[model samples]
Target: MVGAGIGGLCAAAGLQRAGVEVVVLERADEVRSGGSGLSVFSNGIRALDALGVGDAFRAVTTRTEGLRAGQRRPSGAWLSTLPADAVAELRVIDRADLHGLLSDAVTAGTVRTGRRVTSMYPNGLVESVGSGTAGARRAWDRFDLVIGADGLRSAVRTGWPEDPGVAYSGYATWRGITAAPVELRGEAGETWGVECRFGIAPLADGRVYWFGVRTAGIDEPGDPALLRELFGSWHRPIPELIDATDPAAMQYLPIEELSGDLPTFARGRAVLLGDAAHAMTPDLGQGGGMAMEDAATLVGLIAPFAGTECGDAPELLDEALRRYDELRRPRPQRVAARSRMIGRLAHAPGPLLCAARDLVVRATPAAALGRQAAWVHEWLLTR
Candidate 1:
């Protein structure tokens, strides 16, 4: 495995648990120490359970009670109310916390840091930075299987260019966690307004995780004051959250979604997972959760073929990749389209469109909402 991000770590966990000798190569000196937070939906937890880390995750996370969806009016009146079940089986946690958990579970000597994978071949061979003495040449190592769990800008993906690079979603997101004096009453909530959206949830600690997004054509400016100025007046607790944020800790990035064409996941003995396979917008907080699912699925697919005919490995891997694409593609595409549509509706030009959209949200039954997400949340890898 190359890239020690969440996807790589999870894949390593699954493969190692199945008695596979796995070596994870990471370019960074260490795991990412700082990231905002991630929502671990029930499906993601189930995937962790399959890997035997679900209980540990639960111990360090907080289960969301419910979600409060509303729309803010130009005059500051909340014109919408869509109360969702708090016990929707979704939990939220800091990225660093989850990374620590996975890192701890990994067997010693399986993960090598600061080793950059410079290139890869069709065969099961990869070249990475080797130890050198006084400018002497170094040596590279070979593995049976190379899993590319690298993130969106994956070097493996670049090595074997697949679909045209990542597609920009015309919007950017700013994420930060802040101390909250009041406890969050529900799981999480989102407030949508014209071309702007704000979401907040309480973490296991007393801090609240919040993300503010707006449709912008350019790269994020990465200024805390700008985030404050844009979303300061959205609603109660928003400005408070912003004020409580450490200016230096705020992170910003433009949202980008990968095109769903071609089979770039596996070329011969190498395979790609997580964001390397499909990186969608965060309109739905399933990005990390989906990656977790991909890890588990990939492990299951490969475990059945261990020690099989060497000639069959490529065919088996291809079948697994196809199944992965079949199972993961539709749901994430739906989520991406839903997120984009919601953004459009939230940023509608006239009051009439906004009113209509709010009406649909209000009229939609909570049970129906749950059913809409059932296909995603109720997924079980056991089947």
Candidate 2:
């Protein structure tokens, strides 16, 4: 395996349970020490359960009560209400905390950091740079299979240049966690305005997690004060939350998604997973969640070899990779399209369009709201 991000680590845990000896190579010198929070829905929690880290995740995370959220105009008027059931399935956890938990679950010595993959060969031979050196000193190692859990700009995926590259969603996002706990407004939800949106939720540690979205160039200026100016007057507690955040800790990025039309997620003995496969907008907060699903599903698909050593026959692994691609590709692409659509509606460009979106969202029944998401949240691993 290459790249020890969420999908890689969780996939390692699942693979170990299946009695597979795996080595994970990461480009970084150490596990990530910093990141914003992530919202894991029930499906993601189940994926954690399959990997045996659900309990650990619960210990460090908080359940968001009533997935109740709605769009709000600049004047702070409620524009629409999203009634959500399955409140127990939703949680907000700091990214670093979750990363630590997943990393700890993996067996010691399985992960080697500071090693960057230089290239992958057709016969599962992977070349990497020596520790502490980018690509100066090279070494070669062969494996039965290579799984790429690298992020959107993936080395493995880039091998297929004909595939459409990462598509920018014409928006940028700013995320930060409060240095200290601050009093919050609603249980947890978003407030939308013309061409912009603000979201707030609480973490288990009493600190609040929030994110702001707007339609802008990827290079738009991102200073804390500017964030304050952009959302300062939108609503209460929004300003206070911004003020409470540590300036240095905030994260800003241009939103981008992978082209839904990837020729294939599997190439020879190598396969792609997570953002490397289907990078999507954060609109549904399922990028990480879906990656967890990929980990579980990939392990489950290879269950026939759980107790047997099948490494001698590379064809068996090739067949498994094809199965993984067949079962995993379409759902996430559908989700990517849906998430992009929601981003468009939430960040409507004009008052008239925003008002129309508000009316449509307001008219939808709450039960219908739950049903709409049921398809995404109700997924279960059938072993």
Report each candidate's C-alpha RMSD, comma-separated, in the order given: 3.3, 2.0
CA lDDT for candidate 1: 0.73
Q: What's the CA error at residue 8 for candidate 1, in Å?
A: 1.1
Instruction: Extract clashing residue pairs from model 1.
Output: 65-86, 66-86, 66-187
TM-score of every model? 0.87, 0.94
Give lDDT tens digits, candidate 2, residues 147-229: 98888987777766545688889889889999999876554578887788888878888898899888998788777778877
Each model's lDDT comes to 0.73, 0.82
Residue-wise C-alpha lDDT for candidate 1, range 40-65, written one tens digit per residue? 87889988987768888999987655
The per-residue C-alpha lDDT of model 1 at residue 10 equals 87
**Top model number, lDDT:** 2
Residue 172 displacement (Å), model 2? 0.5
| Best of the candidates, TM-score | 2
TM-score of 2: 0.94
